[model samples]
Target chain A: MAQASGKSAGKSFFGKFGVHIAVLIFVVIWTIPTLGILVSSLRDKDQIIASGWWNSFSSSTQTEAGRLPGPEAQVEKDGRFVIEGNIFGDGPARTISAFGVRSATPTQFQAGQAADLGDGVTLQLNPDGTFVLSSPVAIEGRGQRVYYASSAPPRFTTENYETVLFSEGIGRSFINSLTVTVPATIIPIMIAAFAAYALAWMRFPGRALIIATIIGLLVVPLQMTLIPLLQLYNGVALFFGVPSKTYLGIWLAHTGFGLPFAIYLLRSYMAGLPKELMESARIDGASDFEIFLKIVLPLSFPVLASFAIFQFLWVWNDLLVAIVFLGSGSDQLVLTGKLNALLGSRGGDWEILTTSAFVTIIVPLIVFFSLQRYFVRGLLAGSVKGG
Target chain B: MADLTLRQIKKAYGAINILHGIDLDIQSGEFVVFVGPSGCGKSTLLRTIAGLEEITSGELKIAGELVNDVPPSKRGIAMVFQSYALYPHMTVYDNMAFGMKIARENKAEIDRRVKQAADILQLTKYLDRLPKAMSGGQRQRVAIGRAIVRNPRVFLFDEPLSNLDAALRVATRIEIAKLKESMPNTTMIYVTHDQVEAMTLADRIVVLKDGRVEQVGTPMELYHHPGNLFVAQFIGSPAMNIVPATVEKTGASTTISITGGRKAEVPVATPADAAGAAISFGVRPEDLRIATGDSVLFEGRIDYIEQLGEVQLVYLDIGRPDTPLVVKLPGNSELKRDQLLKVDADPATLHIFNAKGRSFARDHAPALAA
Candidate 1:
C-alpha cells in the first residue's frame, strides 16, 4: 500500500507540473499577440519597421548620410582650412557612434577620433553630432558625402493612437459600434426574457411546440438568414419610407438572429428555477407580468448576466452583421468594419493596424473583466444546482 | 380569514390522473396538515388550493365565493415553499415587502407589516441581509415572512421544513406552529411527509395515499384508530407490525389463530361471517411487551435486537420466516438471540384488519370498560 501510494504521489507530482507547464504555454500563446500589438502601437513608426515589437525597448542603430560644410563656409584656423557642422540638422539629436569616409566602412572610425580621408584630409565626428572636417588644402567641393552609424534612443509615443483615433476614423466607428451593439444586445434580451418566462412558467396551448421551434431555430445558421432578412428589411424600409441601412435595421437584425439562442438559454434556466417560487409569487396575488418582473427577473439575474455578456460580446465584435446590414460610410461604419478597412488599406502599416486593433478590443476587454464574475456564474448557472 | 371548500377537485394530465376527486372542506381558521408518502399528491393538492394549478373539473369556493377560475393572487392565499424560494438577490426586508409593494399598498403599511412579520420570525437583525447570506432556517423564515406581509386569508406551507437539517427542522416546525397560533383567524394548510410534524403542528392531519385521503383525524385519533392498513403502517415510526392469521371466532372480541397456533382475542367487533376468514392481526411495536402473565399471546425465538439506548427493538421469528414480529422493549431489558420469548399486548390496544385491509371497529375491552 505504501509503495502504491508513493508511486501514485510521484505520478501526481509530475501530473501537476505538466498541468502548470500547459497553463504557462497557453498564457504565453494568448498574451503574446496582444502584448505585441500594444508594444508595436506605442513604438515609433520607423522603429516598428526597423525591427520586431519585441526589440522596441532597446536602442536601434542605423547608418545615415549627412553633408559636411562646403568650402565656401570654410574658416582658416591655425593656418589650416576647416569645415564644421553638426550631423543632425536641427532635429532630435541622435548619437553618431562612428563615422567613415566610405560607406562600406561606416563604423570603422569611432566617434571623437580623426580619420584620414586620403590626400591630407581628416574628419572627426563626436557622439553629440558635432563634426569637424579639416584639410591641408582648402576644401573645394560642396560638402564631402559622409556616412556614419548612429544609435537612436528608444521612442514611445501616443502618436499611433492619435493617428488611428482621429485620422483613421476608429473613434467615430467606436460610437457607431456602441450604437448598434447596445440596442441590439438589449432588445433581444428583453424579448427573450419575456418569452423565456412565458414559456417556462405560463400556461398556454402549443407552448411545447413553441419551445421546440425555438430550439430548432437555435441550430439554424445565421448565414442562411442574411439575404432573406436583408430583402425583408429593404421591403419594410420602402414601405415605411425610411432608410434600409439604419442602426435600427441592424439592431433588429441582430435581435432576430440572437433571439433563438437567447430564449433557449434563458428558458432552460428559468425552467430550472424552483417551481415553488412562481407558485408562491402567484399565491401572493402577483399577476403573471408582476411575477415575471418581480420574482423571475430578479432570480434569473445570473442567467441574464451570462446572456448579456454573450450577446454584448457577439454584437460588439461582429463584422459580418455590420458589413451586411450597415453602410460602410464613416457615419455608419462600426469598429469591426473600420478595423477590416484598416487591415485592407494599411496592409503594411503595422503601427496603424495594431493601434486600431487595440482600440477596437479595449471596450470588450473592459466589459469582460468588469463583468467576469457574473459571466462565470451565468455560464455555470444550470450546470450545477444552486451554484 | 376564509373557509375553503374544494368540491370534487379532480386534476388529470391526459390519462394520468392526479388528485382523484379530492373533496375537502377546510373550516375557517383551522390548521390542517396533509401527510403522505412521496408521489401521494399532497403537494399537488396544496398547489391546487393555492390556485397555482388549475383543477380539471371542480368547484373551489373561498369565503363562499367561487374561485375555481380565479388567479392565485385573487384567491387570497399565500404559500411558503419547501425550498424557501426567497428571492436570492433581495434583502429580507424587500423580500417580505415584495407582495405589498406589488399590490401598491401604502409605504407605511408595507413597512409596518414587514417589520411586524420580521419581529414574529425573529428576523429583525437580518432584515437587510440577502437570502443567500442567511442560513437555511433564516431563509425559510424570510419566506414565511413574505407570506405574512400579504396578510392573506389562507396560508399554505408545502413541506416548508423539509429543506432544513434535522435540528433546524424541529426548530422551524415549532416556529411554524407558533405562527399558526398567533394568526389563529387565518386558515392554514400544511403538507409534509414527516408525520411528527403533522402530529405536533396540525390541528388535524389528513393522511393521503395514491392521490386520495386515507384518513382525516386528530393525531391521537389517527394514531389510535387508523381507518385502513395503509394509514396504520404509514403514520408511526418503524411502522405497525402485521401478522397473518385466521379468524377463529367472531364477536365483540374477535379471536384469531396466529401462524404458530397461538389464538388471541382482540377487542374489535366483527360479524358472524368473519369467522374462518383470513385476517391480519395488527400490533404496534411500542404496544407489545414481554409477557409475565399466564396469557402469552405468542412465543418466538429472538432473531435480533436493535439497542437504541432509550428503547430496544426485539425481532422474533414466530413461524413466519420472512416477516419478523418486532417488539419494542424497555432499554434495560436484556434478551439473547435464538432464545424463545413470549410477548403480549393489551387486547384493547390490538387491531384486527379484515381481508380488504380495512380495520374493524374496536370495542372497549372488558377490563378497560370495568
Candidate 2:
C-alpha cells in the first residue's frame, strides 16, 4: 500500500503540473481576441483603416508634402503662374515617405525636394504645407495627395456608442430587450418553481406522466411551434384589441419556450432536496404552498437564480423568437434583431458593428459573472450531496 | 392534556401490508414509548398519531378528538423528527417562531412563548444562530423547542435522539426525560429502536413486533412477567436462557422435569391437562448462580468466560439445551474457562413457557407480586 501510495503521489504531482500548463494555454487562447476588439475600438478611424489591428503596437502613417500655386497674380514673369505651400497640416509633421500629384499615384514624390515636370514647372515641396507652383493655374478636380508618416493621435471616444444609441435606433432596441428579458425570466421562474415543488414533493395523480411530458417538451424544437404560437397570440390580441406584435406577445412566447428546461432543471433540483426536510415541515404544520414558499423557495434560491440567468441571457440574445413575434420596427426590435439589421445596412463600418455587438453582449456578461456562484452552487446541490 | 386512544389502527400501502391491526390507549401525561426492531412499523404508528400518516382503518383520537381525516396542521400536535429537522435558513429563534408567525399571533405573545421554550431547552444564547451552525445535539434541542413553542396538548417524538452520538444520545435522552417531567400535562409518544432509551425514559413502554403489540407494562413488570417468549427475549440483554422441559406434575403449583430427570416445583398457574406435555423453561443470565458441592439444579462443563469489567459471564455446555447455557457472575467471582461448574438458581426466578411461547404466570408474577 505504501508503494502504491508513493506512485500515486508522484502521478498526482505531475498531473497537477500538467493541469497548470493546460490552464495557461486556455487563458492565452481565450483572451487574445477580446483584447483585439477592445484595442481596435480605441484607435482612430484612419489608423484602423490604414493598418491592421495586429500592427497597432507601432506608429501609423500619414502622407505629407504640400504644394504651392505658381506666380500667376504678378506680371507674367517667364510666362509662369506660381504658388507656394507646405506639406503638413496645422498639426506637426513627423515623417515624410513619398508625395504624389495624381490620386492613383499618391506616393510618388519625396519631401523637401524639387521634382521637375519638364515644362518650366519645377515644384519644390517642403515637409510643411508650403510649396511653389510655376503654372499658377487654378487647382481643380482633386487636390494633390500629400503622403507621409505621421503618428496618429491616441484616440479613444464614446462617439460610436453615442451615435448608435441616439441616431441608429439601438437605444429603443436596448429597452425592448429589457422588456422581453425581465418578464420572460421572471414569469417562467415563478411558474416553474411552483411546478417543480409539486412535481418533487406533492403526492398527486399522474405526476410521473407530467414530469415525463415536461422532459419530452425539453427536446422539442422551438421552430416547430413558432407559427402556431404566433397564431395563438395574434388571435388573442385581435380579440382584446391589442397590437399583433406587442411586447406582451413576445414575452409570453419566450416564457413558453423557456419553460420546459426551467421546470425540468428546477424539478430535478427540488427532488434532490432531502425528503426528510419536507416531511419535517409537514409535521411542523405547513401546507404544500406554505412549504413551497417558506422551505422550498428559500432552499431553492440558488437554482432559481441559475435558471433566471439562463432564461435571461437566452431571451436577451434571441433573434428568431423576436422576429417571429414582433413587428419590424425600432420600437419592438431587440438588441439582437437590431444588430442583425446593422450587419446588412452598416456592413462596411467595422466600428459600428463592433461597438453595437459589444453593447449587446455587455448585459449578458454582467448577468453571467454576477450570478456564476449560484450556478455552481445549484448544480452541485442537485447531483451528489443531497441526493 | 387528555389521553390518546388508538382502536385497531392498521396501515397498508397499495396491496403491501406494513402494519397489521394495533390497539392501545395512553393515559394523560403518560410518556408512552413504542419500541421495536427495524421495519417493525413503530415509527409508522407515531406518524399516524402526529397526522403525518393516515391510519388505514382505525380511529386515532388526540385529546378526545378523532383526527383521522384532519390535516396535520389542524390536528394540534407537534413532532420532533429523527433528523432534527430545523429550518436550515432560519435562526433558532425564527425557526421556533415560524408556526406562530404564520398563525398571526400578537408579537408579544409570540416573543413570550419563544423565550419560554428557549429557556426550557437552555437555548437562549444560541437563538440568533442558524441550525447548521449548531452542533447535532444543539440542533436537536432547537427542533424540540420548535415543537415546544407549538404548545400542543400532545407531543409526538419520532426517534428524535437516534441521530446523536453515543454520549450525546445519553445526555439528550436524559434531557428528554427532564423535558417530559417539566411538561407534566403534555402527553408524549416517543418511538425508538434503542431499548435503553425506552427503559430509562418511558412511564409505560409498548414493545411491538411484526406490527402487533407484544407486551405493554412498566419496565419492571415486563421484566419479571413477560406474556410471551418474544418479550422474554426482547426485554433484556443476553436474553433469557431457555431449555426444553416436560411437565412432570401439575396442580395449584406446577412442577417441571429437566431433560436429565431432575424435578423442580415452580410457583405458577397451569392447567391440570398440562402434565406429561412438553414445555420450555427460561431463566435470566443474572438470575442463575454457581452451585455449591452439595447443591443441585443442573450440571454442565464451562465452555467460555467473558469478563465484562463489572461482571463475568460463564457459558456452560449443558448438553441437552440447544445452545450453550450462560450464567452471569458478580465481578469478584473466581470462575475460569474449561472448569466443570454446576449452576443453580432461585426457583422463583425460573420462567416456564408453554409450547406456544406463552408465559405460564399471572400478569405480575410472584417475583414482584410478593
Candidate 3:
C-alpha cells in the first residue's frame, strides 16, 4: 500500500507540473503578437526599419553613404593636399565602426585606420564620423564616394502615435468606432431583453413559433442577409429623404445582426430563474412591468453583461458592416476602415501599421478585462442550482 | 379581510386535465391547509387562486366580486413561496418593502409597515442583509414578512416549511402559528405534503388525491372519522391498519367476521342491505392492546417486534400474507416472535368501510357536527 501511494504521489506531482507547463505555453502563444505590436509601436521610426521588433531594445547597425569636400576646398597641410568633412552632417552622432571608399565593401576598413589609395594617398575616418584624406596630387574631381557602418543605441519615441493619431486620421476614426459600438451594443440588448423575458415567462399565442423563428435565425449566416438588408435600408432612406450612409444606419445593421444570439443567450437564462419568484412577485401586487423591472432585470444582470461584452467587441472590430452601411468619408470611416486604408497607402511603413493595430485593440482589451468576472459568472449560471 | 369562494373550479393544460371541479368556501380568518401527496394539484389550485395560472373554467369570487379576469395584484392576496423567492439582489428591508413601493405608498407609511413586519418576524437587526447571507429559516421569515407588509386580505403559503430542516421546520411552524394569532383577520391558505404540519398548524385540513378532494374537516374530525379509506391512511403516521372482512349482520351495531374465523362488532349504523357484503375493518396501530379476557377480536402469532424507546410495535400474522397487523405496546414488553397472542379494540373506536371504500356513520356522539 505504501509503495502504491508513493507511486501515486509521484504521478500527481508530474500531473501538476504538466498542467503548469501547458498554461505557460498558452500564455506565451497568446501574448507574443500583442507584445510585438506594443514594442514596434514605441520604437523610433528609423530604428523600426533597421531591424525586427524583438531587437528594438538593442543597438542597430546600418551602412550609409556620404560625400567629402572637393579639391578647391582642400588645404595644404605638411606639404600634402588634404580634404576633411563629417560623414553624417547635422544629424545625431552615431559611432562609426568602419569605412570604405568602394560600394562593394562598405566596411572594408576599420575606423581610426588609414587605407592607401595606391598612389601615396590615404584616407582615415574616426569613430565620431570625421574623415580626412591626404594626397600628393591635387584632387580635381568631386570628392570620392565614402561609405561607413554606424551603430545607433536603442531609441524610443512617441512620434509614431502622434503621426498616426493626427496626420493619419486614426484619432477621428476611433471616435467613429465608439459612436457605432456603444449604441449598437445597447440597442440590441434593450430589444432582446424584452423579447427574451416575454418568451420565457409570459403566455401568449404563437409564442413557441416566435421562439423557434429566433433560433432558426441564429443558424442563418449574416453574409447571406447583408445585400438584401442594405438594399432595404437604402429604399427606406430614399423614401424618408434621409442619408443612406449614416451612423444610425450602421447602428441598426449591427443591432439586427446581434439580436438573434443575444436573445438566445438571455432567454435560456431568464427561463432558468426559479418559477416561484415571478409568481411571488405577482401575488405581491406587482404588474408585469413591475415584476420585470424589479425582479427579472436585476437577476438577469450577469447574462446581460456577458452579452454586452460580446456585442461590444464584435461591433467594435467589424469592418464589413461599417464599410457597407457607412460612407468612406473621413468623418464617417470607423477605425477598422481607417486601418484598411492605411494598409493600402502606407503598406511599407511598419511604424504606421503596428501603431494603428495596437490602437485598434486597446478598447477591446480594456472591456474584456473589466467585465471578465461577470462573463464567467453568467456562463455558469444555468448549469448550477440555487446561488 | 374577505372570504374566498370557489365554484366548480377546474384547470387543464392542452388535453390533460389537472383539477377536476373543486368547490370550496373558505370563511374569513380561517387557516385552511391543503395536504396531499405530490402531483395532487394542491399547488396548482393555490396558483389558480393567486391568479398566476389562469383557470380554465370556474367562478372565483373574493368577498362578493367575481375575479375571473382580474389581475393578481388587484385580488388582495399575497403568497410566500417554498423557496422563499426573496429578491436575491435586494436587502431584507427592500425585499419586504417592494410591494408597498410598487403601490406608490408614501415613505413614512412604507417605513412604518416595513418596520412593523420586521419587528414581528424578529428581523430588525438583519434588515440590511441580503437573502443569500441568511439561513433558510430566516429567508422564509423574510418571505412571510414581505407578505405581511402587503396587508392583504388573504395570504397564501406554498409549502413554506418543506424546505427547512426538521428542527427549523418545527420552530418555524410555531412562529407561523403565532403569526396567525397576531393577525386574526387575514385568511391564510397553506399547502404542504407533510401530515405533521397539517395536523398541527391547520384549523381545517383538505386532503386531496389525484386532483380531487377526498375529505375536508378539522384535524381531529378527519383523524377520528375519516370519510374514506384514502384519508384514513393519509392523515396518520404508520398509517391506519386495514384488514379484509365480511359483514355478517348490518344494524345500529354492525358485526363483521375476520379471515381467521374471528368476529368483531363495530358501532356504526349500516343499512340492512349491507349484510353479507364485503367490507374492511380499520384500526389505528396505537388503538389496539393485548387482550387478557375472552372478548378478544383477533388471534395471531407475533411475526416481528420493532423496539422504539418509548413504545414498541408488534407485527402479527393472522392470515394475510401481504400485510401484517401492527399493534403499539409499551416498550420492554416481554413478547418473543412467533408467540400466539390475542388483541382487542374498543367497539367505539373501530371503523367499518363498505365495499365502496366509504366509511359508514358511527353510532357514538357525532364528531362530524362538531
The best candidate in terms of lDDT: 3
| Model 1 agreement with the true structure over A28-64: per-residue lDDT tens digits | 9998998998899899999898878888888888888
- Determine which window of 10 residues in candidate 2 chain B has minimal summed lDDT: B361-370
| Lowest lDDT block of 10, candidate 3 chain B | B361-370
Each model's fnat? 0.87, 0.58, 0.89
Candidate DockQ values, in order, are 0.73, 0.52, 0.69
Residue A26, candidate 1: Cα error in Å is 1.4
Candidate 3 yields a Cα-based lDDT of 0.91
What ranges in model 2 sit over 4 Å off? Answer: A1-10, A52-58, A61-86, A91-146, A238-241, B258-264, B296-298, B320-322, B363-370
**Local error of candidate 3 at residue B134 (angstroms):** 1.4
What digit string (tens of lDDT, one per residue) describes model 3 on residues B134-215? 9999999999999999998999999999899999999999999999999899999999999999999999999999889999
RMSD of 1: 2.8
Sliding window of 10 residues with minimal summed lDDT for model 3 chain A: A378-387
lDDT for each residue of candidate 3 in A1-387, tens digit (9 for 90 to 100): 999988988789888899999999999999999999999999998898899988988899999998887788899889999988887878999999998989999999999999887699999999998888999988889978889999999898889999999989999999999999999999999999998999999999999999999999999998898899889988999999998888888888899999999998889899999888888788777777888888999999989999999999999999999989999998999999999999999999999999999999999999999999888876776676542
Superposed Cα deviation of residue B328, candidate 3 (Å): 1.9
Model 1: CA > 4 A from native: A1-11, B364-370
lDDT of 2 by residue, B226-310 (tens): 8889888888888898888999888877889987767777878788899898999898999888877565677788888888979
